[model samples]
Every structure is written in C-alpha cells, then in structure tokens.
Target: MKDLRLIFRYSKPYLRDLIIAVGLLIIECAFEMIIPVLMSTLIDEGVPAHDMPVILRQGGLMVVCAVLALVTGLLYARFAARYANGFAAELRLAEYAAVQKFDFANLDHFSTASLVTRMTTDATVLLNAVNTGLRPLVRSPVMLFMGLGMAFILSPRLTIIFLVATPILAAMLAWIVSKVAPLYGRQQSAVDHLNSRIQEGLTAIRVIKAFVRGDWENQQFDEVNTELSDASTETFRFAVLNMPSFQTVMYTCIVCIMWFGGNFILTGNMSVGQLTAFLSYVLQVLNSVMMFSGVFLQMTRSLASARRIREVLTEQPDLANADQPVTEIENGAIDFENVSFKYNAGAEKNALSDITLHIPAGATVGIIGGTGSAKTTLVQLIPRLYDATAGTVRVGGRDVRDYDLAALRDAVGIVLQKNLLFSGTIRDNLKWGSPDATDDQIWAACRAARADEFLDRMPDGLDTDLGQGGVNVSGGQKQRLCIARTLLKHPKVLIFDDSTSAVDTATESGIRHALAQLTDVTKLIIAQRISSVQSADLIVILDDGRLHAVGTHAELLAHDTIYQEIYQSQKKGGDPQ
Candidate 1:
C-alpha cells in the first residue's frame, strides 16, 4: 500500500488526463448497458406482434448506442495512452534526477546494475501496467455490478447463479495472485544479476581475451540466463491457471441459468426475450470477472517494480550543503585536526586515524605511503568527498563542512589514480574543467602536462575522437590528458594521487617543473618513488593508517627509518618493502 501511494503521487501531475479518460469510459459503459435492454424490447413486442414500426424503432436505437459506445471507447483509449506515456516520462526523469544527487556513501548502498534496472526495466513494467489498468480497471467493476442488477430485474431466480459463482472465481484469482507476486520480485532481481555480469564482462573484455577465458565467461553467463528463464516460467505457470479456472466457473453458471431459466419461461413467469436478455447480462458479468483477473495479474508485477523505484526515490543523500554556506574559498591552505575516518561505520578498523597536519597557502607537500596507508583517503577529505569520522578538515581557513559543496569542489582540483575520458573529441573532454575555456587555454594546459607531444602527431590534433575511455590512446597519453584537463580548471589547490605512475621519469619531471611555475597554487602529490617527492618543501611519511614522519626529504632520509628504507630500496632498483 505504501509503495502504491508513491506511484499515485507521481501520477498526480497528469490528473486532468486521468479524469477525462475515466469519464469517457463511464459513458461508454452506460451506452453498452442500454443495448441489451433495447434488444429485449424488440424481441418481446415487435417480433411476436409482427409490428415493423416497433422493430425498426428499437433496432435503430441499438445501432445508435453501439456507435456512440465505439466513439467514446476510442477517445478513452487516446486519453489513457497520453496519461500513461506522460506519467512514465516524468517518473523516469524524477528517478534519474534523484540518482544524480547521491553521494559516494549513497552510491555504495545500491549496486550500479540494480539502479539501472529500476530506471529501465522496472519503469517499463509500470508503464504497461498503468496503460492496461486505466481502461479495464475502471470499466470492469462498473460493468459487473450493472450487469448483475439488470439480470436481477429480468428474473431474480436466474440471478442466484451469479451470486454463487462470483465468490468462487474471486477466491481462485486471489490464490493465483498470492502464488505469483513474490516470483515477479525474484525475477527482477535475476535480471539485475544478469545485467551486472554482462557489464563486468564488457568493461574487462580486454583482460578476459588476453587470458583466453571466453569459454569460462560464456558458461557463467549461461548459468544466470537459465536462472532468469526458469523464474519467468514459474511465474507464468501460476498466472496461466487464472483463465481456465474462471472459464470453468463462468460455464457452470451459464448451465445453471439455462436449466432453471427454461422452467421460468415455461410457467409463463418470463418471456423468451427476457430469458435471452438475462443470459446476455450473465455473460457480461462473468466476462467482467475474467477481465478483472487479468488486471490483477499485471498489478502483481507492477507492485514489485513500484517498491524498487520507491527505494531510490526515498533515499537521502549522505552529503548536502550547509544551511548558511561560505560561497568562496579564501586561499589554498588546508588543515586537518585530529582527523580520523572509516569507509563503513561498523567496520573494525579506521582507514585513517588521528592525523593532525597543515600545509601553508601555496606550499608544495609530498605524501609517500605504503598500500592501505590512506594516502588517497586523506586527500579526499580536503574536498569533503568523505567527511572525517572523528575531527575536522579545514580548507582555506574554514571548516570544509561550512562551505557550499560546489564552491569547495571548484577550489580543489584532483587528477585521480584511475583517470577516465568520455566518448567525444579531445577538446570536448578538456572542457569539463572549464566549460568556457578558449582553445588557447586548452593548448597551454596541454603543453604544461606534456600531452601535446602525441597530439602534434595525430591528424585531427585537438579535434580527434577519444573513443570510449580513451581506448585509442596509450596509457601514458591518457594520464597526461587527464592532468591537462585538471590544469585547465586553474584551481587554487591541486592534488595528484599517483597520477604520473604510467609516464616515463623524464616526462614526469617535465610535468612537475611546469606545475612549479604556478607559484600561487598549492600542490600535494602522492607517490611511491622517493625521487618524485625529494624536492618538495615538505614530505610526509605514512605507515598503515598513521602518519609516521613529516619533514623535508633530506631530514626524513636522516631521521625516519621507514623513509630511509623506501629511499634506499628505490635507489637500488628494487620494489619498496
């Protein structure tokens, strides 16, 4: 019931269309009801007395009613289709907008494949259900009761057949709905799993082919595909039973009416015309019951989809702007006061713990850490990507939480460890940093990042398409392009989280030298190589989740054991221990 209310709320915007459709359907049903009564009058009065005038009058009236019903029914279909399609478009857009507001923590709560299914497959199901439901759901009950009332008026004795059969048919439908509803939920989940597998395979196809695992991938896909097929078959098996059960009950009622109604006519209590009209009313009522059963079947699937969509629509984003937020950053200085964090609340260990540090405005700070030492985690707090669990993170002399999210992020630029490029020309990708940046600004940034070396050789140069994820470019070239894009932002603070790992040492040195020219912009670089940070104004050493040392590189080499070990290992051409 709660999930259903959510759907109705979204449908409120199309209320005008819904009202028009329902009104037209009611008029159409009323017109159809009058036809049976006219047929009875023609048979009882016109045929027996051989009155051509009465016959023509009633027959013409029936034709007029039928035409009116057809016209109104078509209009109802048009309005219903308009409402359903418009409602679906609005609902899909709402769900997509809600997803865009989600923070990293919220994203972690739902799987990517599951969210995709909710937006597409589940939405499609709801659309179909709305379309079918609008017409038959409104018309069926009205037709059933009107038909029953007419049957009673013609002959109360024949009406007893419907009174008994209706309950039995309702119970059969209820049983089928109970058995099939849960299966539809599971079927949607199976689709999510199948989609997840396909996404994983496509994204990593190069790795799979390199390892020659095509057969293994195929076997895995087959397993999930079989599961989906089996689930669908089971759900439909229960749904199919609805038709046969209702038909049996309907035929039984007809047989009872015939046996008893024949006696009523013989005793002069009813006429042949009245008996025929009663049978028509009985068929109408029973057919309505059968139609209702089909509508219920569609509703069962829609109910499951509604619940999934509700989950997304109701989720609260973990990050939001402050009520009274600072709109601009003062400078590039950053300070962490006893900061600590954990990716999950109930996890056993912290990813970063009890760190107090400060980098002066416009200073260059280098951070070196072993894996799992929280180098990325620490830098992430600067832009409030994840809030500190225990203490405060201040950027530009103000708590990060006190600043508007957009303002804080704009001031801090980061080239992540795993860089990505969208499917567009190289110029399009660079515009993400500053949408209005001129071509001169773009070329200047590229020159600083040393990405121009390859761009100079391409026929299209800046206009070249970067295929998906920059598949056409080499790894080092992709990294350089990402760096150039970030440089174009001209942010007050820059953090490079191992962004130069793929580039040659000479190229990396050139990038560093060019970045040094931006004297007023603060810089923080995380690297495993000692040479990468040896020239920094300050170097910080981290081990596990704790900051172990902070000093100039020469001071660290003399005093810090961890720093000395790393420098010695790298100098001797061996992996850091």
Candidate 2:
C-alpha cells in the first residue's frame, strides 16, 4: 500500500480520466442490477396475467439499458486503459531519472538485478492494480451494497437467511488472506533472487565456461528455480481455495432462500413477484461478492509488490549534491589534509588513511602502491566520489563540498581502472566526454592518446558500434579509446588509474609519450608498472592506506624503502623492454 502511495502521487495529475471511468462504471452496474429485476417482473407479473404488452415493454426497456451500459462501459474501459498505461510510462521515466542521480555509494546498496526488478516487475504490478483494482474494489463494493439493500427491500424476511451466511464466509476469507499475505511477499523476493542469479550467470557465461563450471551453474540455477516454484505454489494453493469456499457458501445460502421463501409464498406472506425479485437480487449480490473474492486475492500480491517498491522510493540518497554549493573552481589545485576514509564507518581498517598531499596547478604527479594501497580511493576524493572521514579535501583552495558537484567534476577527467563502455558507436562514447567537440578535436584527442591507429583501421572509424560494456573491443583497445574520450573533454586535471595496464609495453610507452606532450593539463597517473610513473615530476608511494613516501623517481629510490623494493622487482622483471 505504501508503494501504491508513491505511484498514486505520480498518477494524481491524470484524475479526470479516472473520474469519468468511475462515472461510467456506476451506470454500467446500475443497468446490470436493473436487468435482473426486469426478468423477475416479466416472469411473475406479465406471464401470470398473460399480458403480452407488459412483457414487450419491459423487455424493450431492458435491451435499451443493456445497450447504453455496454457502449459506455467500452468507452470507459478504453479511456482507463490508455490513461493507466500512460501514467505507468511516466512513472517509469521518473524512476529512471531518480536512478541516474544515485552515486556509486548508492548503487552499491542495491544489486543490478533487484533494480531491474523494481523498474519493471514491481512497476507493472502497481500499474495493473491501478487499472483493474479500482473497478473491482471500488465499483463492485457499491454494487454489492446496493444489491443487498434492494434484496432486503424486496423481502426482508427472506434476506435474513442470505445475510446469515455472509459473515461466516467473510471470516474464512480473511483468515486465508492473512495466511497468504506473507507468502506473496516471500514469493516476490524469491523471484527477484532467481532473476539475479540467472542474470549473473548469463552476463558471466564466458567465465563459467572457461572454468568448466557449466554443470555446477546449472545445479545452482535449479536450486533457485525450485525455491521460486515452491513459493509460488504456496501462494497459489491459498488463492485456489477461495473459489470453492465461496461457491459452497453461496449455494448453501441459495438453498436456504428457496426452502424458506417457497414456504412464505405458499403461506401468503409474500407475493410471487416479490419472492422472485428477492431471489434475483440475492444472486446478483452473490456474484458480485464472488468477483471481489478473486480481486482481493490479486490485491494481496499487489500489496506485497507495492511494499517492495516503497523500500526503494523511500531510500534517502546518501550522495546528494551539497546544498547552495558555489558555481565553479576558485583555484586550479587540490589538497588532501590528513584524510582517512573507511568504506564502512567504524570499521577496524581504513581503505585510505593519514593521506596528506598537495597537487599544485600544471603539475604531473604519479601515485604508486601495491594492490591494497588505496591509490584509487585517494584520487576518488578529488572528484568527491566519497567524502573523507577525519579530514578535508579541498579543490581550488576550498573544500570540494563547497564547489558544485558538476563544477568540481567538470574540472577533473578520470579514466578509471575498470574501463566502462556503453552500447553505442565509438563516436557516441567519445562525445560523452565532450558533446560539442568537432571532428578535428576528436582526432587530436585520439592522436594524443595513441588510440587513432586502431580506431582508423576499423571500417566505420569512429562510427563503429561498441557492444555493451565495450564487449566488441579488446581490453587494450577499450582503455586507449576511453583515454581518447577523456582527452577530448580537456579537463584541468586528469587521473588515469592504471588506464594503460592492459596495453603492451611499447604501446604504453607511446601513450605516455603523448601524455607528456599535453604540458598544460595537470596529470595524476596511478599505476603498478614502474615505467609508467618514472617520468612524472613527483611520485607518491602508499602502503596499507598510509603514505609511505613522496618524491621524484630518483629521490624515491634513494629515500623510500617500499618504492626501492618495487623498483627492484620491476627491474628484475626487466621493465617489459
């Protein structure tokens, strides 16, 4: 219901169509009730008196009412479907936009598979509820109440027998519903879990085959599939029980009416016409209640889905943009003053700690460390990916928080360790770095990143399509293309987090030579290869989230023990020469 609240808030703007649809529903239900009464009158009054004119008049009126109801019902259903679907489309768009504002930290909270489920499966559930639930729960209830009242008016004494069965049936249905509600919630969660497993398997199929784990993967999938089946079966068992239970109770009530009302008519307590009309109204009420039973079952599942959606919509974003932030950079420099960061607050260890450094404008600095050195985390702060815990990160002489997120990131171009590519053309990917760039600007960027060579060899050149995650390109090609794309942006500061790692030594050297030619831009190169950082004006070494040393290549070899060991190891590995 909470998830439905958010959906309704979004759908509120389209209330006119909904109101009109409800108006039509009332008309349709009214005609439906009137036809039953017309049949009772034709049988007991017209047929008994042998009056052909009375039968014809009542029959003609019933036909006219049916036609009007059918036409209006069709129009109302058409409008309702269009409006509900349109509102769902709008809701999906809004959710997607909200997802875009989420930062890396927020993304980590929800798995990729679960997010897809929320956007597609959960949204569809809510949409169906809006389209169909309104008619059953809202209009059907009114019809039942009106029919019951009319039944009592026709014969209050006979209506008492029908009324006695209602509360017993209601209690039974409520109990079944209570038992099924938790199962539906668990069932939806099981489906999400199954979806995640299947999605992960498909995405990493190559890896699974490479490791010859196909049989194992199949077994794992079977386990999850079986779990989902069990959950669904549990929910369905309860749902299927409702119909038989409702039919038995309704039929019993009908038998009671026939036995008791037949006696009343024989004893001259009620007229034949009144007894017929009362039976007809009781049948109408029974059928309407039956319709609602099925609808209530579906609502149970929808309510579960709505709660799941609410969990996501109500989630407070931890990476919101700073309020009233300044417009642009005030200086072209970066400072990390005694910064320490732990991904999980109050954890025993930090991802980066006791990091103090200054990067003045127009300087080429390099960061080097072992696997857990926090080199990436150190640079991430400069772009405000994660805020520092015990210190401050200042960009342009002010706290990075003080500058607007767009402005701060605009000044920094980052080519991350994991090169990510979208499903688009090479040119489209590059244009993301600089949307307004001309062909000449793109070519110049490619040349500087040493990516133009292979890019030119492709038949379509920059227009060649890259598959999702750049699956169409090799690792080295992907890295160089990303570098070229970043270069096109021409940011004041560039952070290449081991961007050239996948390329050959010769190609890496060529890219480094090109990077050296971009003398105006500040460069922060983070790498494992000793040769990558050897040419930098300044080099900083980190170990176990702490600053190990900071100096030039020659100065580091002379003073820093950690840097000396790494340099010696690379030398023994022969520097890929």
Kindly give the stretch of ten consecutive residues in candidate 1 with the minimal lDDT sum: 568-577
Kindly give the number of clashing pairs for every candidate.
0, 0
lDDT of 1 by residue, 323-361 (tens): 999999999999999999999999999999999999998
Q: What is the lDDT of residue 188 in candidate 2?
A: 83
Candidate 2 Cα errors over 4 Å, as ranges: none
Per-residue lDDT for 1-577 in model 2, tens only? 5566676677766778888888888888888778877877887789989999989988898899899889988988987886788778877777787777777777777888888887888789878877887777666687778888888777887878766888987887898899899998888888888999999999899999999999999999999899999999988988889989989988998888888888988998877777777777777788778878877887888888877766666666665567788877755578899999988785898898878899887788999988988999899988888878789998778898787888888888999999998999999999989999999999999888888889879989999999888998999999998999899878878999999999988888898888887777789999998899888999988888999888999998898888889888889989823
Cα lDDT computed for each candidate against the true fold: 0.91, 0.84
Residue 161 displacement (Å), model 2:
3.2
RMSD of 2: 1.8
Give the per-residue Cα lDDT of candidate 1 at 347: 96
Clashing pairs in 2: none
TM-score per model over all chains: 0.95, 0.96
